[model samples]
Target: MPTTIKEKTVLKFEPVHLSDLTKITDLYFSQTGIEKENTNFEQPKLTEEFGFPIYKLVEGNLIIGYSYFTVNSSEEIVFKAIIKPEYSFGDLESRFINQSKQKYLSKKELDRKGMKNSIMRMVDWLNWSR
Candidate 1:
């Protein structure tokens, strides 16, 4: 289990599995209005190439959002929180920043005075599981 946001949501950060391709594609298409060719067929390959981890944000039994990251040296994280259009962006950004700060602290503690690459490597290993 990865870190949770707001003590109510459970964050599952892992590689994209065969079982979740459909749901991931559906959520992406629903949110972005752009359907990829062979979403179910090509997504796995794309995910592998890009080193992306599918993060499912769940509250209780309901999934609230999805976030993904590209595991680069900088660990660039691209996230999209699925919510109603009426949701407040300000509050959402603040919460996201806070959660990210917590993750940063945890990483800092694990690095043991190493450089950022070590931390990035740790994140990559955590995502890739190898």
Candidate 2:
């Protein structure tokens, strides 16, 4: 069975296992209404090599949302969060930020530097309304 998080449960950083990867993939396909494919299977490999972490938002045994991260170095971490299709983006964003902050705070000094750089780069992806 998949690990469960209680309602309003919050987590910072937790190690991810192969089982979690399977659960996450299942959740992703279910929520996105997409079929699973074997193409580009490097994500799981990357996650395993770098000690990526996964977090779940659950109500009882049912996962409501999930997030994961990949840390390439002390200062570089990439995060992805997904929620049920019926949920709002605001909810996912809030949870992601909360979890990220926790992970950042707990990271080693070198890792923190990489994480900051990654975050700064992420800002460039956003469009500013004029």
Candidate 3:
């Protein structure tokens, strides 16, 4: 258990299975009472509607956050993240965007229209990922 929700805890991210939704929801509502009050929140039929991998952020064995993403044929990615209300982990959001950008760049077939800069950008991302 976290000692302080105000401080950001280093979290490890890994791909989550569809069957893990119940566990994720349990962790989320455990931190808040408002969710149980409404009963309006519905589980997104993500995999069936948009095919893509979802990643979960964990502190040891507990899943504290998850990112839902979808990439189109044009390489444009749509992303959304759900985190426990008590915790504020900004790095998770940046990583999700970084993954989206990296995916877009990987599929992008940029011609000589600024090839030098494009290569530089890719190199930078590679170094950052390390």
Candidate 4:
């Protein structure tokens, strides 16, 4: 029998397990949409050894979402986050990110190299209108 989490509960962050990759990928595609036929959705290499720490959001035993982030100095740079649509609610993403920041701050060292890159370096990718 398949178990589902239909009610909102206290959520916690846990390391993204190998078995959770499929669920994460499905959520990503579902939210982002597959606009192109050749859109190659590669699973991230979840590890802090390479500076990216990925976590799965769980309430009880069910995985509801996953976040990928890197800590640069005191800042946590979130590369991607995807939650099951049913669980997506106002402030949920921000709260999850803040929780991730707290967890990573205590568990890993900040990336000094990432800190060296300034916002100006990413000007081309930013929209001034926004």
Candidate 5:
């Protein structure tokens, strides 16, 4: 395990393109493993691409994780997140989440709700699996 999360690692959040789904699926399966006792998450389907927005969390040139979320009546509900095993430390997760929140809060289209009142439901999938 890393002794400490990389200091001020510049994280970039980018939308996942159709071409990226294969990589996402591969990583998800690798991280979740194939044990029968492990929680089984539905494999992402291409037909359901329009259902939610997925963002890949990047540090420099490497893609460390990905998150998919949908907005409900009261809050932004994060359906799932898959982070690489090596970069799954709490500090990195916290930083990524905070940045994601800020990105959503700053969206001009969501101004009607007022950023302060916007709610975000975070799911720590890595720990939740254990």
Candidate 6:
């Protein structure tokens, strides 16, 4: 038997939502193993906030992985995870992150924003670990 082209799967990205919390946490636990104990994989308070863009990869009804991000008081965007080793960001990085659209800053830049935002950085990383 041969599979039809229409049956092939195509992955797409969408914003993470409250409904996806469980699945995302599971993947985080699975991907990070026991390291999940102290992590914020189950907490989405900030990620659930506005401007904190979290995107997940979906193929049909399945979520493959997710890209998690956060914004600090510096107004710089922090990328927490592009989770999954096989997640090839490619050109889709622009779909989710546009340097021209926002004052996107790397983790290094966030370091200079001050210790307060840096602590927020740590917490945000914990939340996005999954």
Best model number under lDDT: 4
**Residue-wise lDDT of candidate 5 within 56-106, one digit each (tens)?**
887786777876544455654444467797778877666665666566556
The TM-score that candidate 6 achieves is 0.45
> How do the predictions measure up, each by TM-score?
0.38, 0.46, 0.44, 0.54, 0.47, 0.45
List, residue by residue over 1-130, the lDDT tens digit for candidate 4. 9998796579778887656655655555566663313446533322231223268888788888877654445565544467888888998877777777677668767664563243323222222311
Write one digit per residue (lDDT tens) for candidate 3, span 1-130. 7686586567776777756656655554454342433456643221211223357777877777666544444544456566775555557577764664465457655343344333345334433432
Candidate 1 local distance difference test against the native: 0.43
C-alpha lDDT of all candidate models, in order = 0.43, 0.51, 0.53, 0.58, 0.54, 0.54
Put the candidates in TM-score order, highest first. Answer: 4, 5, 2, 6, 3, 1
Error of 3 at 56 (Å): 0.4
Off by over 4 Å in 6: 1-7, 35-53, 70-77, 85-130
Model 4: colliding residue pairs:
none
Question: What lDDT is obtained when candidate 3 is compared to the true structure?
Answer: 0.53
How far off is residue 50 in model 6, in Å? 17
Give the candidate number with the greatest TM-score. 4
- Residues 12-89, candidate 2, lDDT per residue (tens digit)? 334444456556556766666554555774222111222233566554555656765545555456666676665535
Select the stronger candidate by lDDT from 1 and 5: 5
lDDT, model 4, position 60: 86
**Compared with the true structure, what per-residue lDDT tens digits does model 1 show for residues 1-130?**
8986775435433334555545554554555655454646542222322223244544454344444433344544333344323332456634644454455456445333243344355345543531
How does residue 45 of candidate 3 score in lDDT?
Answer: 24
TM-score, cand. 5 vs. native: 0.47
Per-candidate clashes come to 0, 8, 0, 0, 0, 0
Kindly report the root-mean-square deviation of model 1 from the true structure over all alpha carbons. Answer: 10.5
